[model samples]
Target: MLKLLFPILVMLGFAQLTPVSDFFTWDRNLILQGEVWRLITGNFTHTNLAHLIMNAAALMVFCFIFKDILNPKKLWGLLLSISLMTGGLLLLSPIQSYVGLSGVLHGLFIWAAIEDIKQQRSTGWLLLVGVVAKIAWEQYFGASASTISLINANVAIEAHLIGACCGAILQLLYYFYTLSTASDAPK
Candidate 1:
């Protein structure tokens, strides 16, 4: 587990050392200027120390529980899918500029929760509860609104919602795939 976490920690450390303005900048400048990579890389770059710490802590906590059941290959697939979908959604947004891992976190939580449920594990129910509560908190309490505004940060609430939806859809596809494959197996 430490081996898997080391690279992420190192990347975060490097991100911290760089000037945020150099890496965290986003806007029409990025879109029209053709710096489209910002759509994806922006999620990895935080506006400040607090933003990075909060996101990293949440990521670590979620990974601890999810890593146990999810093989590395599946985990990579899920992350890649979520990142691609998130970038696509952000590109469609009128806000023009946004950044942060909140959408990915939401996608991960949704995916983990669904995987747990499909396996009929109690942990899935707990994760579902957690994701729901997080959604409620972010929606009503505005806890995320502050960090969301740091750098042309347009909250990308739509992206987060879409990511969760995509995760759930993927879970359904995986479930049906497993079922069909099992039924087709030789007795």
Candidate 2:
């Protein structure tokens, strides 16, 4: 709904304003030094306008595909969920810094694809396979060499993996919930 999307558009715009992104980008040592806000804000910031537009467009597509499910509050929760997973991956690794919403976009796509699966849509399986293939490609080839040209930065592929894993966990939780509720319903 416009109610949810309007705010996201606004937030994304806010992220692009000068001076704000510098304070928000994820920096490993900075985090270790206790600048904790980066954990959440980094995902909202971007390396450049192209990078922001790419990620924002992907986010819009995700929202449209899963609009039936991702209302404003739930969208915020999903962002938070994937942000933690991506942040944890960055924290545990030797990698010093990173930024972008692509990581969270992966999780959102995976989550939406799983929802498609629950509805028996073939697109679900296709999306799941495509996502896995993309991750595998990135892991093997390394940080999507091509993105360096587009975004002027290397990709943190691990973030994509972590987000996918988190999305799958969300789907698993829903699976168990459905099974439990179905069994509990009186005949």
Candidate 3:
């Protein structure tokens, strides 16, 4: 696990560099101009140290909690899939730019929670409800004042919604795919 996490944390550290973040952040116009990699890179960048720490901590927690199921390949695949989906969906919103991992973290949490439920763990229900409620609160009211102050930017609540939805959709697709594959196996 340390092997898998070391490289990611290192990459996150590098992303904090001003020039790197400026280059990687999801800029609507830049993407339209053919800088498509921003879709993945932006999610790894951050507005500030506080934002990075908050997201890094969450990532660690989710990785720890879902260690049983999260191998490097699975983790990377989930991160990439959610990042791409969320970034693509963000194009439809009014947001011109974004940088942070919170959206991908939400998606990771949702995906792990769904996995927990598949394994018949009751905690999955709790996590799912908790995240949904949090998203709902953010959407209806707005991001917490403290978070906005800490991150030094207005939170993009739409990204949270899109990321969580992407997680659920991807997990469901995986579940069905496995089901069909199992059924096709010789008895």
The local distance difference test score of each candidate is 0.69, 0.83, 0.92
Best by TM-score: 3
lDDT of 3 at 14: 99
Check candidate 1 and list the clashing pairs.
none
- TM-score for candidate 3: 0.96
Counting clashing residue pairs in each candidate, in order, gives 0, 0, 0
Candidate number that wins on TM-score, 1 or 3: 3
For model 2, residues 18-118, the per-residue Cα lDDT tens digits are: 78888888888888899988887788888889999999888887887778877888899888877877776678766688888888888888888888988
Candidate 2 accuracy as TM-score: 0.88
RMSD of each: 3.5, 2.2, 1.2
The prediction achieving the highest lDDT against the true structure is: 3
Query: Which lDDT tens digits does candidate 3 get at residues 1-187?
Result: 7876777888999999999998999999999999999998999999999999999888888888888898889888999999999999899999999998888889999988888898999999999999999999999999999999999999989999889998998989998999999999999
lDDT of 1 by residue, 64-171 (tens): 877787655665677667766776666666656655667777888898888788789997888788777767766576556555655334465665666676677778
Question: In model 3, what is the error at residue 15, expressed in angstroms?
Answer: 0.8
After superposition, which runs of candidate 2 have C-alpha atoms over 4 Å from their true positions?
176-187
Model 1 off-target regions past 4 Å? 17-34, 144-156, 176-187
